[model samples]
Target chain A: MKDIILIGSGNVATHLGNSLKKRGFNIVQVWSKHINNAKILANRLDCESTSSIKQLKKADLYILAVKDDAINQIISQLKDITIVHTSGSIDIEVFNHRVSNYGVFYPLQTFNKNVDLDLSKTPICIEANNKKFENKLMNIARELSRNVIQLDSESRRALHIAAVFACNFSNHMYTISEKILSESNLDFRLLLPLINQTVTKLKDHNPSEIQTGPAKRNDKQLIDSHIIGIKDAKFKELYTLISNSIISHNE
Target chain B: MKDIILIGSGNVATHLGNSLKKRGFNIVQVWSKHINNAKILANRLDCESTSSIKQLKKADLYILAVKDDAINQIISQLKDITIVHTSGSIDIEVFNHRVSNYGVFYPLQTFNKNVDLDLSKTPICIEANNKKFENKLMNIARELSRNVIQLDSESRRALHIAAVFACNFSNHMYTISEKILSESNLDFRLLLPLINQTVTKLKDHNPSEIQTGPAKRNDKQLIDSHIIGIKDAKFKELYTLISNSIISHNE
Candidate 1:
């Protein structure tokens, strides 16, 4: 059995650990700076939990599912094992000169601890220092997901930035949409069909090719009216900036 | 059979026209400023085509699916007939005293004429000059969609603005993501899982409650690095502004 020590107990860690557990991987322990978080996730993962890095058990794999900035701190304290971090932006080279075997096993999907997501459908981007470890990581990734791809450090960095724009920033747009609707006692659920259809259309072509709306049509009169109608300065600014961006794309 | 004349041959007009045609409604004519556009849609709709308002035959309903600015021109030419404009932001009163029986039939979904969409699931927002006409519009809307909503002009306006943020602006975010991926030779399709997952999580919670990323986490380090990494001035501005907005939401 491939024994694994899943580090971190946040959304990414919790989801990845549970998904791995489902595949019959023996998770030796779950580690986090907070003992309660580790314990909570570990209990659900059917594994041991620890707050201290010193108490972490040696396993076939160490999945460093910690936050981006904290990655270096955790790396400085571990050695002599095949370790991988689940991050989109962080470089695989962060493990250089510190760990004997290090790579990246990044699943390119948004994670929420409570949300049930099929991690197998997510695109896993993998990278490693050497061919043998790369193949090993790819093997594990292939077991978990159908859409696995090899991406270098720079490409992964680009993918991460793209993800931030596509997922995080776009999600903020939905948040703004909900806020706009609330101003007039409208239900956010009313926009779900539009939202779902927006995503569904992406399967056909590039987003830029299929752009729509007043901005795409260069409806300056309607755009101006929308801006004037918006009360918040930040939203107004966002409306204008994003609208202008869309118009520029049309040109 | 109740006769209907669909005005305009654009994305909204084409999709709604075809969906109505499928429901066995008698579409009498397709109208557009350009004769070619009118002819193209009329051919697909199996109806007559006209470029001049003078050539428009009287019908039970005149569906004005034209652009916002040209609505006035189209309305001035018709009278003593039930006329409805398919716009989110436009009020039913755009026909105030200009026409006898008027209403609004707004389908709150992004439309692409070339893309296949199940219009039955789209939420059709209806408003009218009178209760009887409202019911008439409601009946037509109900026939095409399962989610027919009666929104007074004000709420519909807010919903329209929200739709822009949720659909149009969010799509622009996807466009930006694809542009960023192109910079590093990464496939845009790789980000689809992340993008789709972003929308999926919304079903379980409010978008603001579930915002994730360096911005949501307040990882100033990652945000600053991402800003530094972006070469385009506008993209950098978008990155900083949206990140600040996400951070603000977290607080």
Candidate 2:
């Protein structure tokens, strides 16, 4: 069994630690900024917990699942150990000097600790400095997920940006929809089936081809009427800008 | 059996007609601008097809599933028959002059003629001038869906605008994500799991509370990095606008 130490008890770390534990990988330690967070997750995985990097035990692999900003500081404290960070935008160079073997074990999926997800279905994007480290990381990734691919730093960064539009902006659209419904004394639950249907349609069709509504039709009358219906200046502005963008993209 | 005439061959009409047929509603006639389009649908329902409104058979109910713009012209040709247009934005007053009884039977879901959907799961928003007509439409709606709602013109219009943002804008974000991935020689399929997870999160958590990404984090450096990475000026503008909107919404 490969011995592993998990750094960071956040969403990504918690999920990864639990998944690793289920796969029979020996997680020796878990470290977090807060001792309680580390202890909570560590207890669940039957591993040791530490608030300090110095308390981290030696293991075959150290997975840094901390924030993108804190990865550099945490990397400086570890030395000459095989390590990987689960971040999409941050490059592998952050681990270059401090570790003998370094790579990226980024899962191209959103993680919410409370939400139970099938990690095996998630696409894990891997990057490493050499073939040996790559093989080691690939082995661990394969245990957790069926979809694993080698993605370079540039492509990973691009994917991260695309993710912002797909996940973050898309969620914002839901927020706006909720606001609109509530303002009219309607329930947000009314939109749930429609939301599910929109995503379901994409399984067989390209999003570009399936795009619909006033914007895609370029129906100025309906567009103007929709804008008039919106009371919030910010929402109206968003409606216009996104509408124009869709029109431009289609053209 | 309730006799009905379906006056369009588009996505909404196709789905609604098929669904009503499944429920044993007698569809007497199908009409469209072209005979071919009308015949295709009419054949499926075992109904008469007509290109002219003059050929329309008198029925207990007429479903005007045509475009919002063409509604007035079509209504002008019909007289003293109960009719309802399946539109989200248009008011029931469009049928006020030409018919003795008229209403709205708008289904709050996106439809594609080729795509099969459970209309029973879709929410049907119903409105009419009188309680009798309202009851008439409600009976039809109940046969097709469990989620039947009596939403007035004002609320329905707001809901329509909200649907544009939630469904259309959200799908465009997916299109943008696809463009970004394809540019980097990455498969758009890689984002599928991420997209599915994004929507799945909403089942338990509110979208505003669960929104993630650099913009939600207010990470200026990462947001700037993403903007710099975008080559298209239009996309860059969208990135900036949406990021700013997310920040403002959070505040």
Candidate 3:
């Protein structure tokens, strides 16, 4: 069995560990600065939990799924093994001195411990310093997912930015919609079908081609009315900015 | 057979016409100021086409699926008939003098002629001047969808604003994602699963509860990095504004 050591107990780490466990991989240990978090995930995976980086057992692969800012500090503490980080924007060179074999294993999907994840459907983006490490990561990734893509640091960063736009910003749009419905004593659930349909269009249509609304149609009257309808100053500003952006794109 | 006269050949008109035809409604005519647009839709429906509003034939239901600005003009031209406008924001009062049984037969979803619409799943928001008309409209809506909702003008307007946020703003975010990916020669297709998952969360979770990002986590360093990474001035401003909004929500 492929031995794996996860160095975080956050959403990504916990979820990935669980997925790997289900795939029959040996999750030897889970490390977290927060002992309770580590214990929770480790107990679930039937593995050991440790707060000290020194206690981390050497394994075939070490995934440092720590926060982006804490990556450098964590790498500095690693005991020189095949190390990888599940970050999209961070460069692999940060681990050059600490670990000879290092790379990125970014799963291009959001992770939440409460939600079930289908790893097979999620895209796994892999990168490594050498062909040997790359092949190792590829084999592990192929075991988990059918969609695996080799992306360099620059492309990974771009993908991360795109993810922010598609996932984070899209969720914020739902947040705004919730606010709009709440103000009017209307159930936000009323807009759920429309939200589902918007995303469904992406399966076969380019977003620009499937785009619809006052902004896309250049309906100034409707756009002006919508701006007036929005009660919050910040939301109104966002509405205007996005409307202008849609208009710019259409033109 | 229910005789349906389409009074506009715009996106909504074309889509609604096609949907009704598939459901076995008798489409008598397609009317538009642009002769070619009306003719094109009419040809597809195997119905007559008319550019002149004065030439409109009386039918069981006259669907005025034109722009909000054109609704009043079209109603003014048509003599007494059972007229309805497929507008979410416009009130039925606009057709009070023109038709005694006027109503709003708003489809509470976005429409694009190029995309296939599943009307059975799309909620039809029905509102009429009286109980009889409401019942008539509700029966018609029942044939098209299982999710028929009775919404007053004010409620429908609120729903429209919410739809704008969910569909229009959500689509704009995808457009932004596409632009960001295109700049770096990355495939936007990779982000589709994430986008779909974000919307799927709305089916069972509240938008605020499902929200995740640097702003939601209050990660100042990540937010700063994201703002710096976005090259466009407007996009950066939007990121900052939305991030602030999400942070404010948590507070």
TM-score against native, each model: 0.97, 0.98, 0.96
Query: Per-candidate interface C-alpha RMSD?
Result: 0.8, 0.8, 1.1
- Stretches off by above 4 angstroms in model 2 are none
Please state the error at residue A151 of candidate 2 in Å.
Answer: 0.6
* lDDT string, candidate 1, A1-251, tens digits: 38999889998898888878888888899999999999999899888999999988889999999988899998888867789999888888898758778899999999888888998889999999989989999988888899998889888888888899999999999999989889988889889989999999899899998888999999998899899878788999999999999998889
TM-score of chain A, cand. 2: 0.98
Measured by TM-score, the strongest candidate is 2
Show the colliding residue pairs in model 1. none
Q: Which structure among the candidates has the greatest DockQ?
A: 1
Q: Which residue pairs collide, candidate 2?
A: none
**After aligning candidate 3 to the native by TM-score, how far in Å is the CA of A175 from where it should be?**
1.0
| Range of the 10 consecutive residues with the lowest summed lDDT in candidate 3 chain A | A91-100
TM-score quality measure for candidate 2:
0.98
Winner of 2 and 3 under DockQ: 2
For model 1, what is the alpha-carbon lDDT of residue B66? Answer: 81
Ranking by lDDT: 2, 1, 3
lDDT of 3 by residue, B107-196 (tens): 988777877778888889999999998998999888888899888898888788888888998888898888888998877788877887
Candidate lDDT scores, in order, read 0.89, 0.90, 0.87
Cα distance off (Å), candidate 1, residue A165: 0.4
Which segments of model 1 are wrong by more than 4 Å?
A: none
True contacts kept of each: 0.86, 0.79, 0.73
